[model samples]
Target chain A: MMQQERTKVILGVIGADCHAVGNKILEHVITAAGYEVVNLGVLVPQEDFVNAAIETDAKAILVASLYGHGEIDCRGLRGRCEEAGIGDILLYVGGNLVVGKTDFHEVKEKFLEMGYNRVYEPGVLLERVIEDLQQDLQERGLSRD
Target chain B: MELKNKKWTHDQFYAIRGEVLNQWPTGAAVDFAEAVKYHENIPAKKHFAKQLVKAKKNGRTLTQPRAGVALINEHINLLNFLRTEGEADLLPTTIDSYTRQNQYAEAENGIEESKRAGRSLLNGFPAVNHGVAGVRKVIESVNGPLQVRHGTPDARLLGEITLAGGYTAYEGGGISYNIPYAKSVSLEKTIYDWQYCDRLVGIYAEHGIEINREPFGPLTGTLVPPSVSHAVAIIEGILAAEQGVKNITLGYGQCGNLFQDIAAIKALEQLAEEYLNNHGYPDCVLTTVFHQWMGGFPQDEAKAFGVISWGAAAAALAKATKVIVKTPHEALGIPTKEANAQGLKTTRQLINMLADQPFPLSIEVQSEIDIIKAETRCILDKVYELGNGDFAQGTVAAFAAGVLDVPFAPSRYTLNKILPARDNHGAVRLFDIGNLPFTQDIIDFHQAKMNERAKAEGRNASFQMVIDDIYAISKGRLVGRPH
Candidate 1:
């Protein structure tokens, strides 16, 4: 029998952030999408993520946060990922990340500077994220569907 | 050395919170050490402290001193010194030395300690907690190795195990208006927050980590119970990418009839689970509070009955990943540390004692505990899903709709009487019915029992405030409504 296609997705909320709602949602969505998801739930520190990505040879790391202090909370995170040698993985983040409002472009620019593949707002159509992921998978010739 | 490492002389702690805490029936009076080992919530703390002061003033000879909050907060520096320096200092002046420091951590072996020993990070709550931080750090003790640095706590701990010191929403009194997450001051404020979400994600991405959801806010203490829409707004706001994110803590805790909270979370969890599973993600956490307001000690029989009944209900149908059982005395003033200790001790015991016992999740627990939980959830869910956040007016609507029988607001209906008068803003003024402060009687007895237990355990167990009366509820058949 032909093996079922699987994409190892290491998922968790990063930094000092502990929002479990979206983390759970992504788990539900991607598992159904036929990818193998390592559901690392909330309040996760940094090293665990890097270690998991390295251990599983994961294709992606999805981050979620709803607390306002994500800006200060998420400092020095990406460099750790690079140091851990998982720089080629697809990275996705969603949910409210900052405290006290500001501009989205600036937020996007900051994330880009730090090293992120894509970022999403709280209510990004899950379909869009899926579609983008699919395109990335297809380009890599790893698309299951 | 352990004895010598001790910081304070018992007399000082007794004087601070003792007079205020002795008004309850928590069993008997005990000492500071016993209070630390036992008790939970704010009221219990206050009552126990009061009891300790009374015992000392009366010249009661004690066996050993105790460790209480007032003592800990007042003399935090000394404890930290002993805890870090691994040495003891002189008497009297030593206590003064402990009190002199303003922080919880200094330096030891080049490592920094948390300052939570003195106070908490749970900021903004019931007018009383206005200045206090509801969040505190508790070092988690797990059975396995930490996934992070060697000798460090693991990050990939198993299902729903506690964090080294997770930040919990202290919902005693902070208003909904205070949170920066919602009630944005302007569109710019909202956009900036959204951007910040993106940056946080990248931080993790750089580290090959993924955040599912950051549970923020004061939980179920306010109106609107932080709906799915709010969750959606948050997601839409900042998170520009969600390759790995999953759940959010929008599913806050216990308040009024959980009909709405339960149903919404179930729908949201199921919905998100389905959506995320289809998208390739794990089922994330959806918080549901089974607890009600009023932790610590019960001020009166009615308040005690109410909180106890609520706790019993929480034990059965709490669908959340973890549940926090409120102490009986939360409605009163700030619980003495002794009281909080009691509650935590009980919680730990219950964790083990109730482990294998099957909580009738189905209908009929002799006392409609299961029914109330289920019925409340089902009706509330149907309404919320149908209402689509339109008819979402706290627990009032849900109760009127028959989804909930209990009112979330502090009103006369809870006691079967007329409601209170309103202020200019239409908010209820006097919160009376079940609002009684912690009593001295209960505090004293409970402390004594604790002291006795401590003594039996071969520890120095002395102090006037340790009341033994509090444990009555521990093994006492959950009378009046619980199973």
Candidate 2:
């Protein structure tokens, strides 16, 4: 009998936000779903995510920002990834991305242009992210069995 | 900050106004003189301050719901539905996340995107992005008076546009808005920004147009002991009064214990009045608002309604001037307009039924009131002493010294030392006092209450109790017990 390997990912809330409750919930859900999660806790900076992804040989970096400062904190992450020679690493950002009520499309587009692989609305279900990550890994030939 | 409690002089206020009004394009449209004229022409029934006074005089408790949408027409439709179907006596235009953070550019895009999407892209109404004319459209569409509700640390521009657009009431305070909502905003900066907001209200009052100001009372809203909330409310009330605010409502979130909830309302009203009178603002009118449980809600809609109905009962018996309704969809996320209306209608039914009966003044209730008052006095006395009679300066220092700690608040300025847990009856009592300026008697009183619960549960008071109590409501229990 053969078992599939669990995909490892780094998760955290970006910038000066300390919304620990949601971060903890996500950690619990992902771990229970058979994924390896390295949660950096809240108030994480760009370098922290980059270093952790490289250290763990992680496939993705999932960023959550609840304090509406995602635009400022998420900027230049793609550039930082390029500089760190890990630009191919998948980046996903979500949760109250901008301060006001902007269309999630525009938010997603802006983040995608800035190098994020996927962007989510504030209440987007974690299950969607899980499904997408599995598909992305399969497409990239990174899935283990 | 020298605690400039006096109303801002014309030079002081207008000087700041120039910069604040230039923050967004809409700010340029706020003509104060024109806005004052518009407010004067509004019918008395459509004025928030007038309606509140009438409710107080008529001895009726009003109900209000928090609802907002991104698009203009949808927002008006949602509010009208809440007004007619929900039976809300007062209406609110909760601001969107972008506007709350002063990101109007993104809010503008949100408005356009909401139009394209045929649904609200923003959670709340973006009044600032909508500008004065746009907000006036919302005002004209709704029948009842409207208030702006947002968790904004800096509401200077929002205050300018919303008030100019004829909103007669506003909710938030420097301390309440910043500590609970944002992790990194400086308290001193928020306090200064709010001073501008109060002064704007002051100018309106000077022109004989009154606006109602409410200080966000349930800081962090998780098991906040009454005294801690009361102290913050009184401080904010005093700050508003100094800026010529004539009508103020201090609010409290429901704590689930009937006796303690009722006692908190009673004590809040008394303390606000006493503090206002002593501070030489005797003419300032006072009222109370009870927020439905501000902590987590049970996911089951039926169970959520149970929580909602219980809050309505508490608000009615406590005689809060008004009750802020909570929806059945609360735990799920932003509720649909229908769900919001249902919550309001349910509250209306409960309050209407409970109106005829008087709140029972049991000995136990009186004892709760006494304990709340004593605890509040101990904190305020220390606050006053720390300020050396300067309340504002003392407030800054108190937060610095942890004398005014709010549980679970993200502000670094807070001492974060105090911890709260449920008593045997499910009332919130201090678990860890931190650096609160409580007398030995007050400390002993809280200790004994916790011990009662501890003894019953056969566990020593510890941080686990605090964590358990935080999630207790969502798990369908008031007191978290070990499984």
Candidate 3:
């Protein structure tokens, strides 16, 4: 019997944000759920995420922004991913995603319009994220064999 | 440059001071001789070290808040408001992020931008950009003693400007500021830079001026275990003492468990004194600071008050010299002055209520203290052995070998192998101990506590629990249980 290789996923806190707690948590939760987490750590650029996804053939890129500047930092990230030729790669973002208290529905709709596959409000459980990843991966036929 | 835990000679210090003071145009204003004279004229009541000594003698827990703004007059007014309306016992001049990064040019622009906008644009006071005279203006305007609260990895020029400007206390150590605050700064570099800062304080002490030096005790502040933080605090204390610093205040973040929080403070004070004395620095006056929960707070203002009050109760009961207050607007970005004062008043009320109430030294707290001591001793011993009795070398090696890992630290120097989670009662336990130099018995103790939580939650002891615990407090719970 041969062991199977884990499915690949990219994770990081996008832009000049240095919040590492949630990014580390995401890595742990995703890796424990049987995925090869390419943790980009904190203060990552938009290009790094797309480049990593393309290099590793990761099924998804989980971008986190906790410094409340995600609106500006994350702008046009999807178009950059498309230019890098991994536009279809799943993009999941969460955490204090806006400058102040905005309706979650509005925030979520805005991110979706920006081409993110999913947008999470602050305090969403990691379990829910992992489940979403599994379902999304399966629907895209990118699930582990 | 070979880094060692030895004190720099006056010649060596002056040589570096020449360059350090030339970092920006503001640095040119730092005249050590004149500054010492100015410091001599500061009233004893407005002296940071003097006030802390008085607080310790009276068995009082002082309250301080984290605050600053871009402009000078606004910053002065803010500190005064916190002193009067908030009833903060101590005041802080928190430095802006650009200054923390040594980006004085950007800080200058921030000051200009703030002036044109008719409102402060920066998160904190740009002390370095303000220069000695500017800092002196704010220092002279504020009623109480002020401390420079910042996360600068290289605080050499900032230290010169602020100290010369009349701030009596400085916060952050090489290790404390670097590992948690920077992404790629080396331990050797930060530790070396911080030695210069400490030496300046020592020079002040030599001139009969005692300046308080605090090692930021809350590394990463997210689920950090007691032993890890304790080990870092003791190391930093010894490092400061080596540089001739005589007055040191070590700090610790609230871990949320009452017994554990109190035990941590007791263990930190005792361990710091022992290490400093054993290292041949017995004259150092040590104080302890309890930082109100450094993690996420509930978005609701009422719930935020509960968190702040709990932290105050812990600090008061622990009899720490002072408590760093947190605002109810914590969950929402930078707090308004009113919210900041409300947090301080809330903490003051709790401290006033709990001042006379004695927290019992129960068996649970004793056990926690004992465990923390043993675990901390193990790490310190390894650090010593790794350095061949040199703390500077030992610290760099400890992080490299994963012997002194801080959980969730962003430094490339640290191995970052440790993972912390809460147990059944919300006490932090290691899910993965990483390469921490803990004895088998200590490892077993943490594992058992983790196992108990797993059983209670009807879940396996895995990373899921760690995730849940991270957001538990913000969701208004201690232990994150399955719903």
Most DockQ-accurate candidate: 3
Worst 10 residues of 2 chain B by lDDT: B1-10
Between prediction 2 and prediction 3, the one with superior TM-score is 3
lDDT of 3 by residue, B191-306 (tens): 99999999999999999988999999998999899999999999999999999999999999999999999999999999998999999999999999999998988989999999
Candidate 2 stretches with Cα past 4 Å from truth are: A1-145, B1-3
**lDDT per residue (tens digit) for residues A1-145 in model 3:** 1224788899988764667787787787788788989998876889999889988888899999875557656889999988888878899999877643557899899999999999998767788999999999999888775
Q: Over all chains combined, what TM-score does candidate 3 have?
A: 0.89
Query: Any runs in candidate 3 off by more than 4 Å, and if so which?
Result: A1-11, A14-17, A29-37, A45-145, B116-118
The docking category that best describes candidate 2 is: incorrect
lDDT of 1 at B470: 15
Pairwise lDDT winner, candidates 1 and 2: 2
Residues B1-483, candidate 2: write the lDDT tens digits: 445556778898888788999999889999999999999998988888888888888879999999888888888999999998888999999887678778788788778877886776676898998899999999999999899998888999999999999999999998888877666778788887888898899899999999999998888878899999999999989988998899998999999999999999999998889989998899998988999998877767899999999999999999999999999877655677888999999999999999999987899899999999998888888888888887777788889998888887766778778989998989999989999988899889889999999999999998768867877887899999877
Rate residue B204 of model 1 by lDDT. Answer: 33
Q: Could you tell me the TM-score of chain A in candidate 3?
A: 0.95
The model with the greatest lDDT is 3
What's the lDDT for residue B402 in model 3?
A: 94
